[model samples]
Target: KEVKKEIRNKVDAKDVNVLLDTKADVDEVNRALVDLNGQLNLKASMMDITATLQEQALLNTTLVAELCLGRWIWKSLRTKQGGLVPWNLQTANSDPSNLVWERDRTHIVCATPGLYELSIGFFSRRRPLVKVLVNSEPVLTVNTPPQGVTHHAGGRVSQSGRYTNSSVTGLTHHDFLALPAKAKVSLLYEGDDD
Candidate 1:
């Protein structure tokens, strides 16, 4: 009861009202939780709840449930080796964030220049090699069954579309790479040019 009063005092009335609602959106509740972060001493359980519900909300969509999330890769949407991967973005952060999917629906335009990480997870029978291209030129590429990679000086890779096998990512030891502001980035599979 004392803790509840403390929270009510620290947070604004609108946020407090949003908090008391039993049917508030999970994302909205998460926002309230974020507002409380560091404002007062709270139980570890509160932090645990915040972590567990991070960026997720309840869904009642039937088609998504039918697809089972990961099994719906559209083979037809997979473009040729040299072309931009025809991506079908499903969900994104509801809150305004630093990165955004470009209007073209083919690139993720980075708004700020900084080290960034992008993960591409997919299952394909053919080649698993993929490339991360910045503005039409490749940044990171490696050999098949890649041995190792040394990031070229000035942090640029050849534009010829050479890419490494996906497994090589684990061996690289780095989590993020230098990305330029307004960099239009996309992935491409090292598929047959024929």
Candidate 2:
């Protein structure tokens, strides 16, 4: 009985009501804080996912091309010479994207700017020096050694085959070049003796 009397004296009805109100306010504020934290976490996760997806989309934008000078022969040439050689540019066979062959099919025009890996090959009677040119400037060269035999069976005959060896030599070159948008690429041939 005495303890109950002391407790009632220390905490009156009004004091108990005020304490309860303060506790309710604290509980409500805690709940709101928790809700706000959850929302912030969700937003951060969504932003991370969006950034990852954007990076993947950028990576998917790829451009590739393959070209060859198929069976095109240039005869009766002397001295160190280099020029843009025509390529057998069948769009179906070449499978080019973000790039286009010019009207003459001697050069490739880039539609997008990025790093491109170019692989070029040439086959001719003599092992001609192959060069990859960007905007009419030679950036890479490959001097392939003669592959096949040079045959002279009969006397010097006035013919293309007689002057230029008939044996075909293959030359291939690969280069990773950084090109800007609308850049032009071409294959230049040199070292052909008639």
Candidate 3:
């Protein structure tokens, strides 16, 4: 029957030359081959970059680890009340116990600053409603979501550019800090297993 002939044709094409005899299938195979080649090139480039990073770290392991683990960076807000409340940029504070206040004036003092991406999160009870006030500028009232991630425990910015409200209207002073004289910062280990 026709089905038997078709099956035989498909099984017989054990090589590309046989597939090329069927022009349509040959074109499909060629397209797949092109995609695979492109993927291989990208993988090769990534491997090169990763190897470079590894070699550089090995050259300066102590300095690299100190930079990664010893710094505490934050964004600060100057308040009309004449003080500041520093917020950690790495962690998104959700008022874990209904303690995060909105409409409450909070001020922060910057320990160090270098073009920080500032943002505010608006939450009602437990859900994040919006994020506003990004890019060092403060807002009187937050009417939109913050520029970065929302409800993203990971602290990512949202794709849809939103800025939570902030009152960073008259704040100033941003600087960086180096550990104090003879300061020895070490990572505490509960056990060597860590």
Predicted structure with the largest lDDT when compared to the true one: 2
lDDT at 60, model 3: 82
- Best-to-worst order by TM-score is 2, 1, 3
TM-score of each model, paired residue for residue: 0.41, 0.45, 0.20
Residues 23-60, candidate 1: write the lDDT tens digits: 77889879998878856555567767886666343333
Higher-ranked by lDDT: 1 or 3: 1
lDDT of 1: 0.53
Ranking by lDDT: 2, 1, 3
| Candidate 2 lDDT score relative to the true structure | 0.61
For the record, the alpha-carbon RMSD of candidate 2 to the native fold, in angstroms, is 14.4
Give me the runs in candidate 3 sitting further than 4 Å from their true place: 1-24, 45-50, 59-194
- Residue 46 of model 2, lDDT score: 73
* Candidate models: Cα lDDT each: 0.53, 0.61, 0.35
lDDT of 2 at 102: 39
Count of backbone collisions in candidate 2: 0
**Which lDDT tens digits does candidate 2 get at residues 104-187?**
455677766777777666554456777777888888778854356343333233456644544333566566889989788877
